[model samples]
Target: MTDPFAPLPRPRSDLTEPPDAPQALTGGSGVLQGRMLLQVSPARVGLLRPQLDAGRSGLVLCGPNALQQARRLRREEQFSGPLLVDPAVYEVRAASEEEPFPNACEDTFAFDDPLAVSLAEQRAMGVTAPMTPTGYLHAEDSDALKAAVRRVAALDDPQVVFAAPVDVGWLREEDSVRQLIACLRLLAGPKALMLGGQMDPLARHPRAVDHLRRIVAEVPGAALLRTDLAAFGALAAGASFTAFGAGSRLRHIVAPGEKAKTSKNFSTSPHVLFPELMHFFLGKTLADRFAGADGPVCECASCEGARTLDSFASNAGDRQARAASHNVAVLMQWLRTLTAFAPGLARQRWWHERCRTAVDRYPLLNAQLQQPNGFKVPPQLKRWALAAPASEAALPRADAKDYRSP
Candidate 1:
């Protein structure tokens, strides 16, 4: 169902993405959701058929020396059904706990730790997305990411041009944001944008909000890619596609300075989302608060009765994956619905409605949203907020108060 080449599905009248999702979108099992893509290591190609059988797509992203394993999987028929393979440059070296920060001046990909997959090899493989070794860049290297984009294209390979990730943290800075967008504006053809790294802070930042509009305008044809599981809002904002993983960690970017690590345990469950508030509460204690709140607790078949306050107290990872699955499922459904609405009009309506509902759901979160005018609520959104929704009783206005950093 996820043929990357297939044209985007027409928007449906019953769409439930942002501005309008039924409670079920956030409540059910996300496994087998057709639009969802499972990001896996080369060895995990075994998951291809299982995910495909369950109505999902499998994507294999290799790093460093994983080409051989990727080739083997490609050679086998079990993984050939509409698959996408890309090269990912993960960590260069393990981080020293004492020296947590890598030089911001250095390439995000370590210099010595290079891509094992060669140009000849990549061409022979006939992969899906041709990705050059890219990661976070130093402010000096804003040009580096754009340079990498050209390097990947010069090879005359893959059908899609995937840009390396833009560190959201860096994108929040005024100068860095200008440089990155300026570099992207220079690109001649379309490319996929992967926004990564510590997100919550970036999401709340003022500069990042306005810059997002420029990212979309400059690279009008560029695809906005999301792996940062919480960026469904970005889809409404302008991300064209998304990437997901076999485990929860794959769904979000690794720490800026940290090397990639695998967890043997399945992610635990009950990471409940108060959609209205956009607040996430981990563990059973927080989830129990929503018991009987219809669709608040995950009811994915896997966690039918297994998800509970007791299960989380034990701190099992399997429990976390359940909630994560539901979260992705909701996002997938949201993307599906988005296909039906026009980008600007529908998305604006959706964003406003979600904020309205969010305020209605939890006024406390609004306290954070109300943190003053310097934030990016988008001009259209700000206008909408000023009109009908903001004045509604749903959002109780707080008396003028001093701003406190979150």
Candidate 2:
């Protein structure tokens, strides 16, 4: 399940100069003078006054709802940072609608070509569409991934972005995995962001960590590696900044492996999952534990205002909706934490302590579940199921400088 000795692809020679050079890639304009990443649904974009006012560095609209919300917010709210919309959102555009924005939001755009505004327009607004990986990789067709990367690289502003999380699913073949990593590294070039996508559900095996170690090793220059809060603490060895998932992935099944099993004891559907017994239950509980943990010590409103564990549990709603909103808030909080750490090392000790604190709490959840058939989950099985657990192996370490500046 882990790729070893994969033929690493050499760096590509096509060096396209960014038309708008020196400007930040995404999310660099808020009151916070650091890097940030946020994923919001369209429904909540209008309500992001808290996020925009909080001084977020940037926001990435994941789905149509998020993109529509961003466009609406752009009209309503006066944001200071770069804004991003995923390409998938543009695909859903109604031909009747005008160009999605008054102007592009960031250095790189994420929408498809038909909906894409002119490069001149993006440059004028300090926006670019540095191609980003959508976690949909076709293993048989490396060229497709490479071609997508090339198209993004050839943009007027060539800032490549990808979020190909290395997890158990990706571990099916070590060579292909290595090739994918090499391809990503090549795509990112001298400077790129290796944003780690969610690996929580896929982490049900120990080899997942091995795969993660290799993925981290192959891309040491990533701007930041984002992940789930609970998983982040459990797998801190591979990352720099501690981050968490936005629950979109949690709500939707990534593959057949994650489908709910009908058990006499507990139904696995989102509606049936309880919010409290996360380890013991499925959906809602899984999301609540990850979002409420404060594993990253994020200082955002959601983290601070979450009066109690119960409050955090209900922040988003029932199962799926809760995962989406809570995770988005957590990711927003992560950006805030990064801002506090940047421009200096003042927050390094605090960051480590936060991670350790979270890691320490993981076992307690398991221990609490073991109260006379309360729910005994095996540590070996537990450890194996994470996307990137800690490893004794000496994986490569990305320099803090890669993401220290705006």
Candidate 3:
């Protein structure tokens, strides 16, 4: 029995490419292979331009006006990277028998037609590599899953990646995940993008986290889109790429018909990523925590010398932009560290060890803050640390040869 997590021998030349190299957008090449993409709303494009221009991967995702946004990014910001316009087809009712959800389809381009038409729409938006138009699949809907598979398998264009936006509930059932994986295996190309609707952080959903690990591990070229910190775990599990949302709204797929909850007193706060903890905290909350005690200090290029992590909480007008930049810098730093290792068991073990150390550090941080329960270790961190590497037998035999980590 082979240890799937063990490092596979590779030529030195194969491992020397810089971590931030641009992904190839052509046939049989994974567009996002081994890359970390920052999904930013149009408003934050200016804040993130330096990083994007420096070759940090980026994704500009919009609804119906994708072309306008992409054009603005290129013309105004001079941004260079892949852009995706979400068809938002998931908002439309997939079937007449489906329960009525609030229809938000008007904001999205009509994708109820066919995959080729959807690709054509994206091409017009200047997307050289487009994703197939897929609807949100409800849990246990085998018919819908099969239909999506057929739609993707019918496409001969290797540049078009299969996209599936599914209810997160599918991750709760092993059989459901297996069925989805089998369907993805049947696609004409190995690359696929997965979006989970209304998915909480993997830390909160232990079952989903485990199942997600399995999905990425078995499916070569699988990428998790519009996700949060959990994207790192998926990358470690063999995902070709992962995208981090710039804001809360972009972090997870909002279920169709769901409205944003609001109140007069509601205010949005910027969240800062604490690389040491591998979790995000509200800027103010982090400021409060480090007020009287020593806390982890970030040394990323953005905050190396003068700025402290707590400075993100300052009432400065540019606070959000600063925080967002700092977050990307820290994340890129982490990515570079991970990619430094050879891409197999070596990288996997390095990540597992990182998670384990983070889990252990929570207690020390709590003690330092004089609050016993102040820092609860994220459950997903513990899971990542303890998860056993998948055995060779657990891999989908058909796509087993395609399972190379980026």
Candidate 4:
């Protein structure tokens, strides 16, 4: 019988580290220059202090206490990198009329109001880049999106970023996505942040994914927020930057009116990133798979020479903290590797090749682990792997108005 706990073979090319020849790109906000941002709740601020202090990543504060957290990080931790507070106004707009608000949601509304009020509050909190407040973009309404874009364009401060939180399913409507792209183009600067409400990881439908690709490709400085690993696909499609949440709930937007279950049957394991596979699994699931045996090893700064893939299984707070840190470190390495290449075709090709390799290795990894059906590649990842490198000449221009909605 094959040793299911044995380490899987490493890929021929190392995709985690930067190459020696190419010079890393600089200038502009790190977020706009292709660096990944880490979004975390106030309670988890200290968890990523190492990365924050080292300037390896930027931070986006979410949750009700985000303002207070930002103030503390600046006053106490002295984190000087790009920092922003998510106003989370989308939650209010997403809530169904009769649905009761969660504690977090209620607290968010107590501070963050819509439009100008939220911007003012963020400014007072000393947010490095204050995002213009926006409401949820439902499939049927383009007015809210249009107004949000215009509001950002009219703002005198260039540091303001346009935030567009939208229904993930709305991407299926070709016209709606086009409208979004058009509104984004109207912004004074190339600083637009897209939030996919209830997207989980990403849109699975082919058309929806394609539409997302179009938005990322067409928008000059488009970045994805709360995207999780799907941020890789956005980066592949030429996004300026992406942010992944530190925990499962923060990883994706919760749909309006969706209430948390009160059930106690849920597993307490923190989700750990399997870098080679480019997917996250419950730590317990990983422990079970590698029971009594060694599994893949991570060389990320957090895991180097000590933590193995299965070691993150414990549900203890400290273990969860380490798991989160390890995940960020691994993602930062990948970002460095991706950004090392010249932008456009070179970067896209490298990402596609990496995805392809991950896809091909899935079967072998599963077979070796003695679980033939396990480790399926996500549909979006498969799409990226199979996608041809986008031609620079064919890409949409920043000012293209052909798809603009009336």
Candidate rank order under lDDT: 4, 3, 1, 2
- Listed in order, each prediction's TM-score against the native is 0.58, 0.54, 0.79, 0.79
lDDT for each of the candidates? 0.43, 0.38, 0.63, 0.65
lDDT digits (tens) for residues 1-406 of candidate 1:
2346534323333212211211111101122122335455565454333323233344546444355655665675545543445444433321222211223224335553233233335546645444444554533354455455444434432243445555566556668766666554443333455555542424545555456545654553444443543234444455433355544445445545654554322233344433334444455534344343422333433344444423453246454545454444444444444434555445545555655555444434334444333112323233223323112233221321222101
- What is the per-residue lDDT of model 2 for residues 1-406, given as tens digits with 9 covering 90 to 100? 2225433333444734222222222322112123344444456554443544244445555553543455455655655455654433212221111322212235554554432343333233333232242333422346554554555455422233443423244444677667656665554322322222233433454464455546544553333323333333222332322222233342212322234434342333332212122222344344444453432232334445443333323323454444334445544444454444433233333334444444445556655544333334434334433323223333223333233211
Deviation from native of the Cα of residue 14 in model 3, angstroms = 37
Model 3, residue 41: displacement in angstroms? 1.4
- Candidate 4 lDDT, 120-162, residue by residue in tens: 7777777766775465556546655555554555453345677
Q: Write the per-residue lDDT of candidate 3 for residues 1-406, one digit (tens) a residue.
A: 3337634322222212211222323342344567767766666666775655234366747455566777676667665565665555665545212321113444445544455666776777666367765666676677777766655555544466666667777787788889777666554443445454543545445687778878887765677877776667777677777777777666676555676543222244577887778877777777778888755666666776566777766546888787888887777777766666555665666677678788888899888889898767766667887775554223222322321211
Best by lDDT: 4
lDDT preference between candidates 1 and 3, better one: 3
Clash number by candidate, in order: 12, 23, 0, 0
Clashing pairs in 3: none
